[model samples]
Target: MTIVVAVDESSHASRVVEEANALANAFDDSLHVVYVLSRSDFVDMEETNVSETGDAMDLDRVREIAASVAEDAITDANATAESVGLVGDASSEVTRYADDIGARYIVVGGRKRSPVGKAVFGSVTQSILLNSRQPVVAIRKD
Candidate 1:
């Protein structure tokens, strides 16, 4: 059976990878990593989107940063198993990938967030929990 992990190169993500690897080792299953680059991360040089809340980040730059983040997560995951696969998008992307690979479960890392941040950002964990058809295991960073 294949286990899919949603990684973002964060402490939480690392923890998830560790847990996933442990489970994989015990069950003799393969581990797959999915790193999501949000649509807001795709930006063109000529276009500029300014938010009323004054939070503006370059989509193109975010993609580059996300790629770096994915690389780091992949490296960390490799320490456990050399055979690792990467997919983009922690939300829908992860779900699609899991379906594509016929994964039995999805392991996701959830970080502690403030009430305000949670309200505004809408945690990916929550989204996956609500959306995924397969079982989703959310690993928290302690």
Candidate 2:
């Protein structure tokens, strides 16, 4: 069995991974950490994208950043975890990744938001909770 943990460079990734690691240890499962670049990230990247050489950052660089985010997020975790990076919607991508891996559980760091806030801005965590086939384990940020 596998435990899938959705993470980003921001958010309480360490907390989420810590919880997921505990569950993995209990279940004797491997862990997979995933970082998804949402549409917003892409747009932001587009707006302020520059490399050290002064060239615009390419998609490959964005993907590399994604991989690094996933890998870095799991550094504090007790167990060694596989990291994957993908580009797309965070909610769908995380769920799809979990389903593809046949994960026993999906762990995510859920940011608390007001009902009005969620309705207006939409919540990736909320979407994952509702749509994922795997059992969801939500770790709220402190």
Candidate 3:
């Protein structure tokens, strides 16, 4: 069995990684860590600024941060598997990765109750659950 985790730099992501690792260890399964970098995030900010010249896109910096996040998660999990940075919507990319990896389980961290529209709705989780054939475990922060 392969367990896939959608992790970010959020504190909640640590708990989700730990939970996923525990489950994978119990099942003797390999663990896969996936970090989705929204395409919007990868855009060249300087270009939009329109006041900067001779400045290259800071792809190296972005890659460094993404690698750091993935490394931390994988290290904390203490299991060997693949780590990938994908460019797309979080849910869509994660679901596709899950399918590609033949993941038996997927784990995602979501915000706890929040003010206004910041809260993660049950429907959103339900949609992922519906879209994924594999079981999805949604972890909420305290």
Candidate 4:
């Protein structure tokens, strides 16, 4: 079994990685870091015109951008006994991957949000917590 950590661009991601590493060490399990690039991310990039050449970015370009960001997160995760994976559908994909890999725990970062704020902006962490059959650990930003 493995310990799965969901990685994102959030500041709290490093903390979540650290926590996952520690858990993996304690449990003698491998660590897997997963980053999910949602369709909304692609839409946002297109809408915001992230490319300097004003060219329409294809899925490969978007995947490259997402992979670069995920690599940064993995570097922050300390790069010890960790393999990184990427997919689409942020919340569901992470959970599905963990299930497929037979993960012992799913680690994620938690942002401090008021009840109204959580209601207004649904959280991926909340979705993982509710949907994952594996045990979950939520690390907050320091």
lDDT for each candidate structure:
0.70, 0.86, 0.73, 0.80
Using lDDT, rank the candidates from best to worst: 2, 4, 3, 1
Candidate 4: tens digits of C-alpha lDDT, residues 7-126: 888876777778888898899898887777788877877777755558787776776777676567778767564545454778898899889989999999987889888889898889
* Residue 41 miss distance in model 3 (angstroms): 0.4
Ranked by TM-score from best down, the candidates are: 2, 4, 3, 1
Question: Residue 96 in candidate 2 has what lDDT?
Answer: 90
The residue-by-residue lDDT of candidate 1 on 14-63, one tens digit each, is: 66777888887778888776666655444432134443435566555565
The 10-residue segment of model 3 with minimum total lDDT is 116-125
Model 1: per-residue Cα lDDT at residue 7: 79
TM-scores of the candidates are: 0.70, 0.85, 0.74, 0.80
Candidate 1 displacement at residue 88 in angstroms: 7.2
| Clash counts for all predictions | 3, 0, 0, 0
Candidate that would win on TM-score: 2
Total backbone collisions, model 2: 0
Off by over 4 Å in 2: 43-61
Write candidate 3's Cα lDDT for 1-142 as tens digits: 7999888877666678888888888899988888877677766453654446566657655555565677787777665656767666777878988898799999877764444454444433445667987899988777
